[model samples]
Target: MQTSSTLTPPAIRHDEWALSDVHGQYSDANSHADLYRFLMRWIDVSTHLNIGYSRFGQRHLTNANFTRLIDRIARPMLELYDDSVHRHDRRLLDIGSGRGGAAIHAHQSYGLEVLGIDITPYNVERANANARRRGVWPAVSFAEGDAQDLPIPEESRALVWSIESPAHFPDKKKFLHEVYRVLKPGGVFAFSDLLAVPTRVRQWPEFYKEFLRVWDVPYLETMETYSEALWELGFDLRKTEIVTKNNIDIYTGYARRYLTYFRIPGFYKWYTGRVRRRWGANLDNVREHLRHSYNALSRGTIDYGLFWAIKR
Candidate 1:
């Protein structure tokens, strides 16, 4: 394990005016609003921003168990660089880090010094506050930055990771290059995200296209395409695993929970009315898209992919 003394303090950029602008934009975007965060926390009060992992053979898991599984998936990336020679250099850069859960988990579990960055300043603020409340403060820090243009210096990180965030990147290739630039030689880059099976994408129903549009994801790269891009950027591919089954199970569980939660008298009316008023027709579109996304997973039109590679 790496001791804190060997780790350099994370450089956090502060642009107060820009942060205020981002906060206003983020609040206006319903998907990124505090209510959404509240709903997510309602689903799982634990430290996580991902859909629950279902590898335990249960369609649904307790919040704690689900968060534990999320951490379990990240453990292998840490283990890959655990040799004695590299043990003292465990610095991590988490791109698109939401609420700092994954960063905090990595710090607590592996003693990795983590710096998390997200485009949303509100998320960064909340994540930093979470780190302080959890007593991890300086060991795990959060900042606001775009993934495509990482704020860190070149070759500064021993590991770069993201969770379920690549699909949201408008220019994934640019982000890949940035990841390569920031990682030390032999450093690992690990991530998990939604992928499109090219063959199935062309065959997708109209509803699926609507789902993609509503979700703000123009397109997704297949696992093969993603790996090829990594290779082109000079990363040595180490592992790629399809975890679509777990994603499907997770969505199914969420749908079930949504229905059950809605059954509570005034809650459904209040929530739905609020969404309808705020987002208008987009509310129905978003809900329909969620359903379609789950179906797309079951039909193999979309997949969840976990990948790991080394900067070589």
Candidate 2:
């Protein structure tokens, strides 16, 4: 806990307390885990947590319709799967799998038996409940576990993937090393991550700061950094791609919608009461947060990277 002496003013400062929660979002002491427990408690993971995939000219998809986009994150990576080698069985592991949507999708689509692990306990419970509701409970299981110190045994998983979740890991190198540790020989490892360009980030620090503050990211590593780490760990890199435009702009339109919503008189007061009851913090500043992140992505300060590699 921070001493009161180091605290920011509790006034109606969006970037401080009232509207913007620029404090305790992420740091050496405060992690993304704390941010989820404190600030993002009210968020509905099914709809809000996953980034929308609009690459195929689709937009505004909801409910079951959104599953296609969700599968996009897993499909490209799982395409490496070979039925010839494992004709009767295919098992996979998902790191930081949120709410079990993609895990269930993997099972339904590719006949993969998936084990998803998440750092958040509530997310694990919700993911298990979702698996039961989807009738995939035993086939698609979720457990509470940290990424940097995965609970799974070494040389156990034939395939593993994570989707858009590693940005929040305080120790990116440690997380990647752990990923290497868990894979079986010839196992394929795939993941998509939000990345940073160090030079661009250093050019405009505040935009990056706001992006981290809103999203609860401790720090970021570059595309090159991750690729080099994978090579150093003896993984043969199969593919690495970055499409920042597709990853980020999906939310800019929503940010504009919420910006208008936030501008409405009395909306702040109404939201304040709702958040107090709902364990929420920072919806009022969601627009600013998204806007800054989009700006970073759009301006080349950050990147969205998809990687596929195999252990030899």
**Most lDDT-accurate candidate:** 1
Q: Which lDDT tens digits does candidate 2 get at residues 1-312?
A: 544322321111113322112123321123322323332443334423456465636554344323645565566666665622433348889898777888888888888899998876656777888889889889999997889999989987888888878876777788888888988777888888877766677676777766766576666777777877889988889898886656465555555565667677698678656764676444434445556656655566677778988887
Q: Identify the leading candidate in terms of TM-score.
A: 1
Backbone collision tally, model 1: 0
TM-score of 1: 0.78
Tens digit of per-residue lDDT, candidate 1, span 8-52: 211111112233433443444544233343444345432455665
* Span of 10 residues, lowest total lDDT, candidate 2: 5-14
Could you estimate the TM-score for every candidate? 0.78, 0.77
Quote the positional error of residue 169 for candidate 1 in Å: 0.5
lDDT on C-alpha atoms for all candidate structures: 0.68, 0.67
Error of 1 at 20 (Å): 14
- True-vs-predicted CA distance for residue 278, candidate 1, Å: 17
